[model samples]
Every structure is written in structure tokens, then in C-alpha cells.
Target: MNTGIINQQGLVFLNATGAPVLSRADSRQMRAHITKSNFAKRRQRISQVETKGGESNKQTTQQALHRRKRSQQKSQRAALDTNPTELPTTESPPCAPSLQLLRNFRYLVFLDIRPTVQDPVEKAWFDLITSEPVVFEASLAGGMRCWGPDKESQQNADLHLSRATNLLVDRISCEQVPSDAMIGAVMTMAFGERLADNDVAWNVHMEGLINMMQQRRHHGVSSLPPVFRSLIALDFMNHLLGFPRFYHLKVVDMLSSHGDQVLSKLAPIPADLSLLKTAVDAPETGHMGQTSHGVEEPLERVRLATRALREFNDPYVKATSRSLEIYLNLLWPLLFTIDLESVGSELKDAMSEFRIKACPYMDLTSPHYILGLLATEKDSEASAWFLDRIQGSVQVMRQRGWSDPLSVMKRGLVHEPHIHHQFTALLDDGINGLM
Candidate 1:
């Protein structure tokens, strides 16, 4: 109970009272005891002060050292993993990712099941604009869960995309594949590449995809992935968006079927609009190639293809849905903003009208880039609702060790130009609840 290191001998001397004055040796002992007691008291006082000050100093010192060590290790790892002199590439792997390649193979096996969506043939032109952002946002949303880090998920995504591209390219070059296999192959590639932002190689991939679809059109294929309709819709949407013609969805007359001179319609642009639009007449082409009755042939083809992918992966959030709707919602506005002289003014007007109709009706599950579009419009009602929902969802994320979702979106949506202040306010509202 006592903090003082008391001596038994000192207690005995104190108890001696008036009986110890006769002996000189006793007097010396008494004086020595008093001196020792005073020294002990001063030492105790000094130790108490040191204990309080030492603890805070130790904690601060430990934290600083840990931070420095972590920073150094991060720099070292960066130097090791990255090539300072070389540019990073998309298709050519730094080395073959056997595990990722295997994963891609396994994924194809699972995805080839009977179509669930209403079409199959139109899947070649799957939702091109929104796919990339959806993939991107899913990876970010995925960062919240107990799984591999974001970089690993991204690599896994890249692995599937690159592997699919290679497989399809090889399949197209080598020989004829079963119709079902062709649909499955294109679906796999589309699924892999849809969420890849500004991935220009999609045209080459889509070109091959359409070629496969064309070869398989005569024979009816059983079981289409459900997404086939949306894919075809995306192809039309891509053409409408003034992107290059990555697909070959054209209509031929009965005369052409009889081996007569067939009318070949070319898309006015390259499937990837990021590249220069090809020199082609817009008046001669159709965004969705139409048959004699103004029906897109892929309409039925897409309908059959859509039936292929039946079951859906349960999405944890609207942003992670297997369907391309969420990203499409974001893509429409971005597409509307593009002023392409090559595109028919009617197409541009239609897109603008569609964007306006859709813009005010975004649901909570919309991609984060919708915030960028919302910022561009600065719609008071839309902003208030979106900001409220975002605040509620991401507030809980902080407690769960997630980085700010708004900040995440800030980075995700940077490709689109908008009022920086308005966007910043939205981010601050969700992050700091400033709104």
C-alpha cells in the first residue's frame, strides 16, 4: 500500500524515542538514517515526475518510427514492382498470369449457361459507355469488404479482360466455333472489358465479336447469356454516341440472301470514338442496322441472346449489379455532352433529349459519376436528394474502416469535366456532411 521503500532499521530508530542519547555510535547511526530518509523522499518525487513524462514521449517516439519505416518499405516496393523506363501495356502481360488466366477459364465455364435476358445476338455491342465505370466503381466498393486489396481486384479484372481478348482473337483466326461457344466467348470478353474506361481496343474485340455472331446467325443457338440484349443495345448506343463501329450489325435484303449484290452499310465512325472517326457517310448508315420493316435484325438476335444469362450475381449495392443499367445512367450524360460533327445532328439531338429525360430520375444505385453529371446541372432538388443518400450510406462506411466514398468518387469521376466547386461541395457534403 505504501510507495516509499522504507527500511526496518529506520522504523526501529524512530521508536527508540528518548533512550538512545547515551552512545556516540547510536547518534551516528541516527544521523545516517535521517540523511538516508531525506534522500529517499527526494528520489521518490523525481521518479513520479519522470514516469508521467516518459510515457507520452515513448508513445510519440514509437509512432514516428513506425511511420518512417512504413514509408520507406512502400517506396522500396514501388521501385521493385514498377518499371521506371517502360510504358505499361494492356494485352501483353508482364508475365503470364497463370492463376488469373485459369480464373478467366473457370469464369467462362460458369457464364456459358442458358441465356436469361430477353436477347442473345445483340450482345456483341454490349453497353460500351457504362461498363468501364461500373467495373471501376465495383472495385472501389469492393475495397470496403474483407477481400483482396483494390490493386489485386483490378489485376484480376485486367487478367480476365486481356485473357478474353486473346482467346477471342485466337478463336476468330483459327477456325469456326459453335454458335453457342461464339456467343459465350463474346459475352465473356464484353463482361471483362465493359468496365474498362477508355479502353480503345474494344473495337477490334467487337469487330471479332460481330464476325462470330454473323457466322452463327443462320443456325439457331440455344441458351443465350441474359446480357446479350443489353450488349446489342450498347453497340447501337455506341454508334449513336459517335464512337467508332466496333460491331458489324447490318441488314440485307432478300435479293442479298439470293446471292445478288447486297447493300453493305458501314458505321460512320470507328467503334472507339477515342480514335478518329472513319471516313464514312452518316446518311448511308444506321446506328441500329434495320431490316426492311425498320426493325434492327439484332433486335430478335439480341432478344434470344438476352435469354442466355439467366441468374445474376447478388449485388451488395446497386453499383455492383450484373446489369449495365447503373453505368448507363452515368454514361448518358457524358455522351450527351459530346459535340461530334461527324454524328448526325438528329442523333445528337435524340441523345440530348434522352439524357435530359434520364438525368432527373437517377436512383440511389446510380454510379458515383452521376454526381458529376448532377454537379454539371446543379439541380437543387436532385442534389439535395443525392447528397442526403450519399451522406447516410458513407457515414456508416467511416465506422467500418472505409475511406470516404465521396473522395473515392472525386477520383473516379475526374475524367468528366464539371464545375470543380460544385463537385467539391458534393464531396465535402458526403465526406464532412457539409450539405
Candidate 2:
């Protein structure tokens, strides 16, 4: 038998009309020729299609670019029509203009006044004054005088003061009182003097003035002048160190010696020793409207004690020691108050006792240290206990609308990233290591 083969477009054809004819060489040659022709045709088609697709894509992209350009031009034209005076004719440079040093000086002065101004109109006036280059230049000259040592420096200082006074007078004349700006100017003068360490006399005079302002007992006085009260508190704390006998006296004592007078002027004093003993010793006293067992309610006792401790007069060392003791004593009941089956109340008691013993030297600033101590025995269990207490306190605060110390501390820890970092670092150190 013989086979005949035909080839066209890279395909082999069998010529089987009449007798069959077969030849391997003829079949191989025919297939090769047909394959080559078909491959060339497919390649050509692919190349043409790719070129057409590329051109179509390019056209679409160009159309989009043109549309975007037109939209931007329209926006710019509309902006010019709406605000012709403000629109720039030419494209602005990418680089920003350098801030003038004088302008910066004015900004600082303006910011100094912003917090004190109650009226929005007065605030806006101060803002305008600060934004002006002339005001800034005047401020810079005055600031420089705050340092230079010469008669000319004194003249410059006087000129700056005159400029500020004139600005203030102008505002007043315009029926816009410059109370906020005047206070800011006064504060700046005091602060500048303090920085220079030039004259203690100015500080003394200011202190006297602040005291006089406070004596007026106006509603605004409390918000207006805290400087004098702060200084008095600092001095009182310092003086207590020298006079150990009076260390028990609180910062409030410097206001007036008579407890009745002081109490009348401010918030009510926390219950006295007599009142506290009565409340604890006899539950019937129930000043806070809670029937108590022989044991005091920890949170209430802490609230009262903290207030009393703040008011306590004593040497710094003795007062702080007493305050710690009182605080620890108030917190001691939490050990028994917790559910023993769930949290191991006996361990809690032991931890509380340990804290009480360590209270003399323990730094309350680092809360993680306290947490570590709690976790020393059965860490997982202790963490659970601490978390539970926090939840309970949060619940109570929600119900009563009054925050507890733990809640305040927890919020602080969450918001302050630095504190949180420190806390986590301390936690990693292990509770037993702290002990």
C-alpha cells in the first residue's frame, strides 16, 4: 500500500482517493511546510492586533488628560471671577515664602493673649495686631531690650512699653477694651524679668499686686490671678521644712488660720477626725448616706482622707508620711470587699499588707510597680483581679457620674503614650523582681 500527502497553511492532507499510498518522508515534509505557513500568519495577526490596541489605549489616555486640563482651567477661571482681587495672574512657585522673624514675634505675643480673652471681637483685634509686621518689629525691639545692659536698653524698653500702652489706649478709645492683651503684656513683663533674674523687687511687687487682686474676691479673680496662690502654696511647703512643728498644716492654712473662715471661703472640709471616727465607729452617723459595718468603705474613706491630707498642716516629711499611711489605711478594706472564691481574697489581703509596709518608700508615680507587686504571686490571677477592679470602678463611675482615682489613672495611662511605654517596660521586669 502507498500513501499520498498534500500540505497547505501548515496542515497535512491525506490523498486517499483510489488506492492508499504511504510515505514517511513525504508526510514529514508536507507537515513542516504547512506548520511554518500557519505560524507566520498567526504571528502577523497578533502583531497587528497589539499595535491597534496600543494606539486605542494611547488615544483614551490623551482624551482623559485633555478633559482634566479643561476642568482645572474652568475651576481657575471661576475662582478668578469670584475673587478677582485675590487671584494670582501667574502660577505660584512651589517653594513657600520664608516667615519673617518679626511676624513670628508678633504671633507669639498674640498667642499669649488668646487664652485670656473671653470676647471673640477682642480676640480678633489682638490677632490682627499680631499679624501686622509693624507690631512684630516693635515686639522684637522690646524683647531685645529685655537683655541688653545700657541706658539705651532702658530707653528701648520704655519705648516698647509706650508702644504697647498706646496700642491698648487706641483699642480702648475705639470702645474695644484690651483687658486680655493688658493681662498678657503684664504676664510677659513678669516672665521676662524672671528669665533675666534681674530684679527680685519686680517679682515681690507683682506678688503683692496679685494678692491685692485676689482679696477683691470678685468672680473673675479666681480665673484671673492664680500666680499669687501658687507662690503662696510653694512657699508654705518650703517653710514647713524649716518649721517641723507646723508641718501638719496644709497649703490651705496659709489662706487663713481659722478653719471655719477657710471652710466658708472654699469647698467644705472633709470630715474631721471626730466626724470620721463617728462615721466609722457608729454606722448610724451615715454622713454620706451609707450604712457601714465596723469597717469603713474604702472609696469614701479615701476621698475624705485625701481632702484632709491636702489640708493637713505639718512638716513636709511628716505630712507626706502621714498622708501615705492614711491613703494605705483607706485602701486596705478592698482586700476583704472582693469575692474571695473568685479572686483569692486572702492573697489580696497579704498584698495590701505588703503595700502598707512598703508605703514609706514606694513611689506612687510609677503605677506599674504597684501592679507588679500585685502580680508577684499568681501573675495571671492577679492580672485578672486588677482588671476586674478597674471594670467595677468604671461601672460605679458610670452609675454615679463621679470619677474615682483609679478611673482617672487608667484614662491617663491610655491617653499618655509615654506613660504607657514606661508602664509596659516596668511590667516586663516582673513583679518578683520589684519585691
Using lDDT, give the best candidate's number: 2
Q: lDDT per residue, candidate 2, 331-373, as tens digits? A: 2333223332232333333333320111111121223333333
lDDT of 1 at 125: 20
Error of 2 at 290 (Å): 37
Q: Which window of ten consecutive residues has the lowest lDDT sum in model 1?
A: 85-94
Off by over 4 Å in 2: 1-142, 145-155, 165-178, 204-222, 225-435
lDDT of 2 at 196: 37
Candidate 1 lands at a TM-score of 0.30
